[model samples]
Target: MNLKFIEKILIVMFLLTFGIIWYDFYTFSQPQLNMNPDLSYSRLLEYIKMGWVKQVDLYRNNRLAIIEASSPDLGDRSQLFRVNIPIAASQLIQKLKEYDINFDAHPIPQKNIFIKIAYNLLIPFIFITSLIYFFQSSNNIPGFPNLPGGPGAFFMNLGKSPAKLTESTDDTSFDDVKGIEEVKEEVEEIVSFLVDQDKYTLVGATIPKGVLLVGPPGTGKTLLAKAIANEAKVPFYNAAGGEFIELFVGIGASRMRDLFVQANKNSPCIVFIDEIDAIARKRGGGYGSTNDEREQTLNQLLSELDGFKENSGVILVGATNRVDILDSALLRPGRFDRIIDVPLPTRLGRSEILKLYAKKLSLDETVSLLDIADKTAGFSGAELANLLNESAILSARYKSEKITKKEINEAFERVIGGIAGLAMESGKIKTLIAYHEIGHALIGSILKNHDNVEKITLIPRGEAKGLTWFKSRGDARLFTRAQLTSRIITLYGGRAAETIIFGKPEVTTGASNDIERVTEIAYKMVTVYGMSSLGPRAFIKLNKTRQFPYPPKPMMSVKTRIKVSREVHRLLKGYEKIANRIIFENRIIIDLLVEKLLEIETLESSDFYNLLNQYIILPSK
Candidate 1:
């Protein structure tokens, strides 16, 4: 297991091997194995005649044996001693006994001395090691054909669930996870059925066959499934959908069958398949023509789910962020009957997740969680938890005793885009970012569908060097033409800022995403929404008819395509010019905010609003 231990075994084998080899050659003339061959043949005969055969077996064969007790030696080889084979054999044996060799010895399978030495020494050792390995392997994990639990075989157990026999997932308890309360409630109800199926059955209520947890990543889909198992107090059968596959054929199907069989044996149990999309994705999406293996796997899963007895008490719970891409059969009623939607965590939910994850992390006593919460509006539960963990690690790396508000802020920034690297500037870069952000807020502040603008930051989040965030108006519904016009202007704010302050060629490519978004919006309005001078029409849709998933447009000539491209360019230019004018009017205030941004990378909407209060009357508190 340890390097030193392996070294010890190797060292023992090496020393024993060397010692045997050295003794064989160095002491071949020694009295014990080889007696005096130099002695007269007649003298050795006298000793041999008086002695009895101590071990007759080896000598009884054709092999010549030398008596070990004689004080004699094999001596050195000499070409001058032209000995006759049979004539010298009796003479040599008599001489060997005189060398004081006590025991008889054979020539040791003279076929290959090196080979014979190796064979004799290594065979027993190899046998012993193999024996130990087998016994250890056999005794290691009863019933399961697993490797020994010792460190040598540790990796053989990879991919097996580490979930212990606790009857539940207590480590992933509901309290530690927050937000998506609706999903939590839904999961808890499933757990209730598992724990008290008889109660529901007595009232003539049948438990749902399956529950599908649908959500974006980090919305606690997997965690919710664990909470169900924890609440039910039943053995949870956990396996990822991808875990079903193997290099060998039918293993995926076999694994699935085994998993279902285990769940049914447990009776009231939960089978949580994480990332079900791995196996449940539309089978024909890949393999060009078809994949019989994948199709078979899907068919096997379907049969086990739908054709099985309802009261078998094995409820399937599957989690996938890409539920829309899943097979339609999986979504049918009685199969994942209740599709529980786990939405991206709200701000309040992020706070609870932050506190829970940060509960044990060292923090400066002055860290304001509510402030952190307000700043992290759109973060998911996993993202928030990771933010705290990464901050604490960063604090430790920096040798800071406690995580600072600065660290938390920096961590949030890191999660969004990346760590603000050496992109720090000296002169007027921050000023440009500030005015750029303000242009966005200025346009958005007047819009109704867009909630009041929340924060503007030159401090980069994700790829954007600057971003203007607008709070959502309730559910954040679709936009109309007027709302979309403001949206396009807001997107073009950076270019407008550059144009207003630096003018013309000074406008950088920092607004690539903004420009792209603006282009997309303008194009969608024309081709899809038909808000442009272009008549009501739709362009792109994914369905097989490929006919817009609604209605196909009447054939358009080459002339119409060029005219539409011109209209799109005109719309983008019109928004850019209008946004530039708005920023130009407020040039002095833009200069002041940009200076502030250079000093501190972020500015909340309230602060920007206060600065603009005298010039523009923002809609009332």
Candidate 2:
């Protein structure tokens, strides 16, 4: 039976037991009265002497009598009256015979003694016994602690550690991890130290007490920790940062202490805490300050890391995406001695990830992992795995034994854009959308710094009525001013095309997202990148707040702010003019492309470029 079902049954049994006890007491104490008043024995006798008594009934061992009589006081109507008889039963019988009244004697009904005992004693005893048994059974359930008195006693287990302990296993190791070769090298050293501690200790070297893994989400931080535990062949204690915190005061601190106690007992173990920033956020009082429980938990954690007692042989590994919000004490030299960064995969790294995931799937002969990797420039390890899984699902849906390139292509498009919507009917709206998308592709082909156009489609996907894809190299870590300017012009191409093809007033709101991106790039150029006439100084200061030890504010004169605004406007206008000129020069090709796009509704990069080359010379990169 489910535990919840057992709990409900026990509660219902308890309520039913109490209900029976109450019902018995009420039925015995309150006798039934049929809307009649009590009469004295003398009054009853007078009624009988006056010949007003009609009938009588004896009840409760003949100690009570119900009489039906007519009297002037009762409005000359037959009425029933209850009266206590002090005389003996034989005497009452004699009196009733003398008056010649019709009478019937009723014997008191006896109840089952077993039922009485069950309602009064057995039921209550069973309820109490079941309650105790339920509490005892709860002790065996995970997460509930066994108290000294009983399982259902006070919440003494609130302080108990909820961390899960896993014995050493060879299921996962560094060999199973891919796409992070540099991070793996750093972590392998730690595993080597754990496997042979004397090698480091003899040379007067101490293993880091804690290793903090900082990176964006889905970048293989947690996977690295698992590999460490498996490679080192030591006990692993896993817990989330949230498990140490609770709403009750002192519970968080108590759990923190208990966690360290267990870690101490299992020395030479790896304690991995995921999302450590939850409990170790910077401590301060402000509008969004954490509660006292969380702060207390953090303090206890600090004490355990580098307190009077030496925490040797216990290596702590923590992973977090938000390292900026962690407390300084938690990140200091003695606590977190090593901080490793796990970044997104590069082009070569992505290829390795794709190959690793592809081993599990059956692909067609023509399908290539390298081509897929090139298309997925910014995808993480988890996303790459998901893309292949989606392709496999599509193959199954189509009743194919092996995944084909067509399925992979469709899955890739679905993952990047949303699911494809219905095909649009050919009309003025479709023509306008075609022109808008063509505008973007034309500008991208003409720009020297922009990436090459990959695909263009008139089929609606997600919130976009039309879409254009760019094939990025994904290896560039830095961009020059010219590259940034070229991106802005490419973004403005759609609006520029719409304004020239249809009148300015006929342009639609399809470019809202594009305009937002253009504005962000232009503002960042002036404020953050210092790429405009505003000079080579960042005008924005980050991490400013009213919390303790606040950062210094950025000082800028009102006139300088105005100049910054003007510079951003100048950058936008200059790029927009360039985009318009390019679109105007390619008007004939644009019309021909629009007609072809309306007929087919889709075009690949090779086909698009083949047609464009027939009309004009393409720009050389």
Candidate 3:
């Protein structure tokens, strides 16, 4: 169960083994000789009558005897022999006493000092330790219980829920969380309902049975749930969805029932289940399904949520990144009525988060939170926190007392890609990558609709040989067809530059990721976004209820599919031509950017744009 308990058990076993070994040695050490049955009893009487017997040691309640006799071969030397006393041998001890023969009625010692210590001291010590372990285990100290044999034999309370009942403390409040204001506001209203239900009840409004926090991973969903509990000053019951499902059947359902019962007992409380997708996957299983336990658990959860009344005061909050795989019933009107989308933070939110993390760090006066936030466009809250921590680690590594802007930027790159290591050293491959990345940057800078070229680097990061990042000059909610085409053209710039500089035959597979992004955007534009010749209606549905479910018997005919393919192909070719033209016209600028990148390995937004402005002439739009 615990280290101390296990140590005590081992000690007890060791003492027992030692005692057994001692007893075996003691028994084996007793000197005895075998004698014929009649001769043994008759010789004992003969020796007693002849006065040759020196001493007789009687054991086994005096039924057996070790006889010490004088040996004639060695004149007066004594020898030892054993004999079993017969029923008529009752007179043997009396005859020995009448003859005045030396005799001892010593019982062979059952326990010596060691055995006595083991039995009296070690056994009692182990018993006390066992009692302590049992009581500690009964209180659930996060380990297997040492119940007699092992944990496997102790499954009496296996059906009990593993959720911990915790009362929220005032330490973690809304002020601690910096970004995602909209998410905070929504959860804050839930806290209001929890704290003062009468305010909502006057309008005949009922609090939602469950609130589902759906977002990508690392978006601080669980933090918001804790904030709600803290604000409401209610009991918080925490459990992961995986904890409900077990290998045995019906265990999951039993746990679900137990959790609800406990939550109901602690009314005016919040039950937060993180990663609910583990048990709440879509119901209908096909041929090779082995999720019977999980399905039963989900069914129980659905039943609990459906059966809840307004003033029951037990709110269920579930967080998941994979809501698409969840059962539709879980997202219906009554259960999980509020589906809050906790999207990634914006630029302002990132700035706030950076500043909040930087408050504890000794940052240099030159460090600007706004500059760091501007470069980290798509970073989540967790990534941002990790970025600051990495910056501090770098600072410590360099023996600096404070974090500088340079260290923060390096850490940012490490977080986005990976730590800088041995890249291709000024070889043909390095030059090729430099040109490829510069091509993307040049195209982005020249195209008005495209985002501003953020950073261009020849240094390898992640799976790419080189990377060219673009940042939105302004946060535009909608993208026009022109803007999408400009992005596709920019994506093609890498391949186009390779073909232009190193001949068409020498173009490598380095543009695979770029091609993938371009294809996805093109496909989405045609079928889903309705941005192509296929017309204004969406030809493909998202269908979040099921994963890769069959299409509803082809909404469009074969001709429509052909049309969509043709449109996608046309957009790709058209963008390729535009990229080729841009690269050809700005060949000097592209070459200059590549040369600079090869020298420095990385160029920030200001450096890249300044060099681009020197060679490229802009059209006054």
Q: Give the top-scoring candidate (lDDT).
A: 2
RMSD, one per candidate, in order: 11.3, 7.2, 9.1
List TM-scores for all candidates, in order: 0.68, 0.82, 0.76
Q: Over the stretch 517-585, how does candidate 3's per-residue lDDT look in tens digits?
A: 998789778887888776877767765532233644335689988888899899898889889988888
Higher-scoring candidate on TM-score, 1 or 3: 3
Q: How close is candidate 2 to the true structure, as a TM-score?
A: 0.82
Segments of candidate 1 deviating more than 4 angstroms: 1-166, 169-177, 202-206, 288-293, 347-375, 388-410, 422-425, 428-438, 441-481, 523-538, 542-570, 595-607
Model 2 lDDT tens row, 1-621:
355666676777777777766776665533476748899998988898999999998887778888899999779999889988885535778889987999998776555685578677767677676766555554443443223324553354678876778887758888767888999999998897788888888888877888999887888988888889888888888888987777776888898788889988988888899999888988874333246778888899888888624337888899998887899989998899899988888888888988888888999999988888889887888998999999999999999999999999899999988899999987888899999999999889888889989999998889999999999856687888888888999999999999999979989999999999999888778877888776888876544221222353445788988988899889899999999999998899999988888888999999899998899787787
Q: Global lDDT for candidate 1?
A: 0.67
lDDT of 1 by residue, 217-290 (tens): 88788788777777777777776777665455565666676667666777788888888877787767666322
Q: Which of the two, 1 or 2, has more lDDT? A: 2
Q: Cα lDDT of all candidates, in order? A: 0.67, 0.83, 0.81
Error of 2 at 478 (Å): 0.9
